[model samples]
Target: MRLQAEDGDEQAAIRAELEARAVAGTLQLDAILALSPAAPSSSEFDFLSALGPVQRQQALRRLLALLRNEEGLHVGDASRLADVSSPNFYRLRQLWRGRAKSGLGFLSGYAGRPTRQPRGVGALGTLGKLAAENSAFELADRSIRGLSKLIQEEQSARIPAYTLDAAARHLRQNARNMPDVLAARYGFRILIDYCAVSLVASGSDGSLKLVEIAWVIEETTQLILAARPVLDVGGCVGQQRATRAARWYIGRCGLDVPGPPAAWIKAVVPDPVSPLDRHHVDRMVSVAGEEHVATTGARRFGRLVTDVIGPILGRIKIIPRATLSENTSAANVRAFGRDILDHQSIRARVAQSVIAHNRPIIDMLRDSRLPLLDAGDRTGTMTSTLNDLLLRKG
Candidate 1:
């Protein structure tokens, strides 16, 4: 019995050691969890970029074939035909499926080891809309340099964890104090902040109602997961709304979801400046779908607010979606929707305001750069060239 007891203790020690390694990310899980590509089409693959010119083109073809024949594919035959190992074929297939983009990017000839990818600036794209929104109007006093610096700070804080290893390491370092919620990986970091919203009309008539805004954004896709406006004001409820939206976002399978978002969380970053605190961080982790909260360190709270969600939602023209809580019915919301949200004039004006930032931004120079634009009226290429550009980088 003593020997058995000793063996049991030894096994527990080994298991604990393994989990610790997993938390620190010494154990590689072949990186199955990654940012889901936000759209249907994609162009570049980092791995494919490493392949030789000929092999690169071949890889695309192989990936395309695998996608086409996923159901009836004889793994051995497919790999032999593609002249790649079974494991390689599987890996390619996994990557293609995970990104969920139609495997369609044709290789270009100018391949002298891409000098550098263009700087992808998603924050700057939303600049105009942000400037117009009351929620972010504080920037009116700041200089361009300050604005740029602030955007950089927000981006650094909201960077997506692409692999399980990256997520583990990030949570370990940043959230070590909050051991109760340490196991959870966030799809978005939510922030409980304030916004200047109009209670009577969607239109700004000089004065506006100030309400607590839940600025929740999925770092990976750089997309606002929920369309709803938050009516609640406290830390716990605001986080619940944000994470609940994230839960809905993650739970939703795209036309056909391949797997899950890397790290799978809808967490809110805490702000010392804002009245909202981290009281709800634990529940935020739980509802986002993790069972165990680590009991190691004090909960980590107090950080900068990422500025992506509020401005984007503000610029949507029509209020997207919101039902923060049943108890807080927000009679103002009802009147606001009826008076402005559902109005014919507002609906008609949507097309004009919809893609406020979708105007194509093409640049031209000498041999240093070549610029081109091939677009018809009302079809802005900004979404393809800019919106997805940053997401693809992530």
Candidate 2:
């Protein structure tokens, strides 16, 4: 039967291409670049056509190169295949290394460095050589110095003056006062709003930005300040009492309190640029202190709880035997609850009394993930928007 142009035909074409490539021992990229006689029309599929034939071919070649070199290609081999010098190759390699370590393997493979491919004077080789010559750290330091000079010039300051030092001091002072000011200005409502915004922003941007985290931190710190009155009045005398009272009334009931610090999240949360895994969450929980994590779903809650108290158990380094489940420990659970509930702000947030906060403005940048995405997307997240400044082939 003749296939429908919209779905069936496209599926058939794709399948045929896959089968043919499988038979020909070509990569999927190679098969696609080969171009089918029954290729979809531009009107029917604008996205694929937008790539154009030349671009498709180039992309396909890069893909194949990555597949061949990813595993076997070392620093030297990549430069040779990219047709770049050793120095240039080093830079690309570092960029790739940074990407891979950050959980962005998809980007590394596509940009350069595929599995087991040997590098020896290819299209990307020459670029690699150039990159090795330019170091990212050196580039960042120079850029900072240049910015300092420019700011000084704009202010009509002395030639030898350093403005960065002053800026740093000012920022630090502001950060110190930020917690109290937040409580006075926004209150609990703004704190919740900020957390919601942070979640959305973090997902949209691929990774959380400094500003997003800062908002959360600021809101959270303020929330903590607001809760002081309740704590001061003997609302709960000791840590255990606070935990029990909070658990009885607030836990998961949506109480709203100040959330964990940005520093806590930054230290705990794994690199988002990389692929997600259960282990990453576990590691985060270990650092986060189980008391601080709020349980939502059942298994997810258990995991979060374990993550909170896991470190204190001293069993973090070792997996428990199946038999240990029978010898349950109530003390551990009580301790976890008490430890978390003791902190008024933390308890409020966990109990849903207040919104979980993000990083403060000053500490916002300590764990930003934009640079990884920029490097992956070919859009320069760090360095500069100076792609046009650099010499390149069309």
Candidate 3:
């Protein structure tokens, strides 16, 4: 009975020693919890929990090294506490230092290759160069497969389709090889024209309605000044609408249109032979001048309109889709006009679109070394005369 009791006590002591060794080797959850109340619920904790025992041990050892560094514990003491060799402790310290230098990128799971020489970096570069060159020539043609084929044939490179597609999109959106001669030459003096876009509103009950869009462009700068939507009850825009639009544009821009002697405003319109059209133009000529208001034949005017405004308007997503449709009802038309086609709403959208389109032009103009035209100074005398007329009328 005495020998049996002694054996039982020896077994208990052995079990206690095993438990102490286990506790010494393992990370203290209570200590971690005391340090950070939210640690148990954090993503780092979850990641650690998801890892296998061996990986978990490695990660915990590194974490212990980091904590020891933070607490200003001695390296040798920290190594002993983590049950790691001095070499491993120094390596973990280096990893912690790397984390501090590279930010959270050091934790990213992309261990295949560095970004500078990624798995398909050569193929991606080849695709990007081809895409940029092609995008310059064909602004609208962006086919990823076609670009991949071209790169494969031209450079003997085999790039992944998704990689090529991503590269193509990046090139197409960012490439700016187009010449900015207009922006370089003309700062802001521009020409204005109106185009009637036929739309099938859901409320129009299958009937087509005309919405007039005014194209204000700087001829020399080739920069789109504005694409304003005119709310015209009449299907066609006449002299009154044109004059009003011009006046609104001038007022909004805070421009001083110099009188007859100096041509502050230069406009090219379709020649009008009819007495009524002539009368309308004569009034405008009085405001601008006969020299500034040149008239061209229908063919020439049509070509000019197409060349100047087609490309600019083609880039807009809303303009092209404004087509006739049988699904629209009269009530829908009224609602659309009130909600989407209202003067204020349309103007606001136009202003936003134009601002985006003009950014490059503005940048080019800012960087341009060309001499600017002194339109205001050249036409000061005419401006004074017009001011007098306004005062007299008032």
Question: Which candidate's lDDT is highest?
Answer: 3
- Tens-digit per-residue lDDT, 56-167, candidate 2: 3433433333322453556565454444567865554555455423221222211212222112212223223323454433322233334334334444334333234333
TM-score for each of the candidates: 0.26, 0.22, 0.35
Candidate 1 vs candidate 2: which has greater lDDT? Answer: 1
Tell me the spans in candidate 3 whose CA falls farther than 4 Å from its real position: 1-190, 198-208, 233-278, 283-302, 312-340, 370-394
Candidate 1 lDDT, 76-169, residue by residue in tens: 8667545578898786666556543322222212111111111243323333344345232244223334455444443435533222222222
Clashes of 3: 12
- Candidate 2 vs 3: which has more lDDT: 3
Candidate 3 Cα RMSD after full superposition onto the native fold (Å): 20.8
lDDT of the structure predicted as candidate 2:
0.28
lDDT of 3 by residue, 1-394 (tens): 1111125677456334433433455543333333323233334343343233544455554454456446576888667655678887786567556643322112212111111222353545565566446535363234444544665566555656655554544343233223433322233344545443322222234433434454555544445544555454321234344434433443344333334333245554434556655654565467557776655443322232333333233223223223222223345344333222334434443454455455555555445543433433433322333332121221
Write down the worst ten-residue block by lDDT for model 1: 358-367
| Native-to-model Cα distance after best TM-score fit, residue 8 in candidate 1, in Å | 91
